[model samples]
Target: MTTPPQPPERYTQLKAVGLLIGGISSFQIGATLAKGLFPLFGPSGMVGLRVCLAALILLTIWRPLPGQLNKKTLMLLLPYGLSIAVMNFCFYIALVRLPLGIVVALEFTGPLTLALTGSRRVLDLCWASFVILGLYLLLRPESAAHGNLHSLDPVGIAAALLSGCGWIVYILTGTRIGRTLPAGLATTLGMSTAGIILLPCLIPTLPLIATHPWQGGAALSVAVLSSAVPYILDMMAMRRLKPRDLGILLSMEPMLGAISGLLFLGENLSSARWVGVLCIVTASAGNVLTSPRNTHH
Candidate 1:
């Protein structure tokens, strides 16, 4: 039997919930902002700028000492960093040609698949079915309101799927790193490694920034909102929220991305896409709510 949480504990939990929502909102807003900059910087440049600057901001704030890094740390950070690089690179590439909400829903399949993996429960199959229906509705040409199936770019969809695969790698390696290093330290180092890998991509953006200095400020804002601030807030939230609660809250992201795209980027979705988004959101929430506790696959 468990005792009820006291008032102070309840307040802290509420605060953590707020932080998690804030992080999600920030990330969506940042993505919308990055989409706006695509005409100026291109997807590769924007990815490079966002991740590199985000890594710099995180490094400055966490300041992981040299001694904190070792062979084992490097081993963990390498894959984590590669995943980050691949995830962001592919995500931005897809974003360039796809609606923000659609991209988010598609990319979310990675974590959704991760959660539902190895579950033999009959109820879990319902969630999996929801995912499949949602994907079909979202990607089918007939579902397009404009009556043009080609409106959805095949390459963009493929990139989003690839990005999802990277996310799987990121989650697995990140979980392992969390056990060995402090959260902030591991995040900083992993981001630093990603920055190094993306350096060549960032190099080409320097000339463009030199011409338009305001672009630098915009990139920094993207970095803070998308990565640095979210990482910090998520770490803070994880300390107080249960994993189930955190996951349920996170399931709201696709909806939030849709809302953000509509409000900030003026990207409207068709009825089919909206239904697909809701289906994925429902499946994600159901998976978190119904999955067995204390069991890892």
Candidate 2:
């Protein structure tokens, strides 16, 4: 009973797919680039620069009105923004101490767990088991020849896990805010609030820009690649792709992070960690394929 897409429509859909992949690549690239600035700016400083610059760019584009900030909206935006701050702050901290791929793989558990929350289905239990096995493999101690898991900083692991918690909050609050406000406006304001919260960290890094102007440019690139481009491309992709299809494509993010880390940062994962990443990736994709159609985007 359903009509197939026309050729032109199919072409557009293909382009959307490409854009989505590109957005994912851009985000990973941005993270790699951000890591390079750690020596000069440190994780907090780099995150502050990236978030504040991204907020400025988004504000310029969306330019949401002051009247939109009603008390009700503010309540939603505050928690959403705080989540962004916490997520990025902890993420960068983890990134400083852990390999980019490993950090991303660990951080992804937040959203994966969120997706599985309240589900009683047997298949969902399988997916949750995959996550647990992956975590066990990733965190368990190993011999030196196999790349000792104990070499990974406990603080870094904790930060990555905490970042996942922040991400859970980000998703919950952002969803509610999206229902009440335009997506662009909500994102802009939330990012702005995060920037304001991160201002203290940005302060110390500002003076360094004069001595290392290139790092400033790199920070801006991080803002554009990580935030603005991905957001814009995702908006376009969502319009053309089914929610499930989009989710499936996005489930490749951890793999993309690993690839980006290897290619750009010269980082390599151990065999056990590689298996851990695969398990998580499989669980993520499986969740997407099996998720109820009526679930919130």
Candidate 2 lDDT over 1-297, as tens digits, reads 977769889898899999999999999999999999999999999999999999999999999887878899998988999999999999999999988888888999999999999999999999999999988878776677746435688999999999999999999999999999988899999999999999999999989988899889999999999999999898889888988878888888888998899999999887898899889999999998987852555
Q: Write candidate 1's Cα lDDT for 1-297 as tens digits.
A: 977769889899999999999999999999998998899999999999999999989878889877887888788889999999999999999999899999999999999999999999998899999999999888987534456554589999999999999999999999999898988888888898999999998999999999989977898899999998888899899999988889899999999988999999999888888999999999999999888772332
Candidate 2 structure lDDT: 0.91
Q: Assess the local accuracy of residue 216 in candidate 2 as a C-alpha lDDT between 0 and 100.
A: 92
Tell me the deviation in Å of residue 208 in model 2: 0.3
Give residue 34's lDDT in candidate 2 (0 to 100).
Answer: 96
What is the Cα-based lDDT of residue 254 in candidate 1? 90
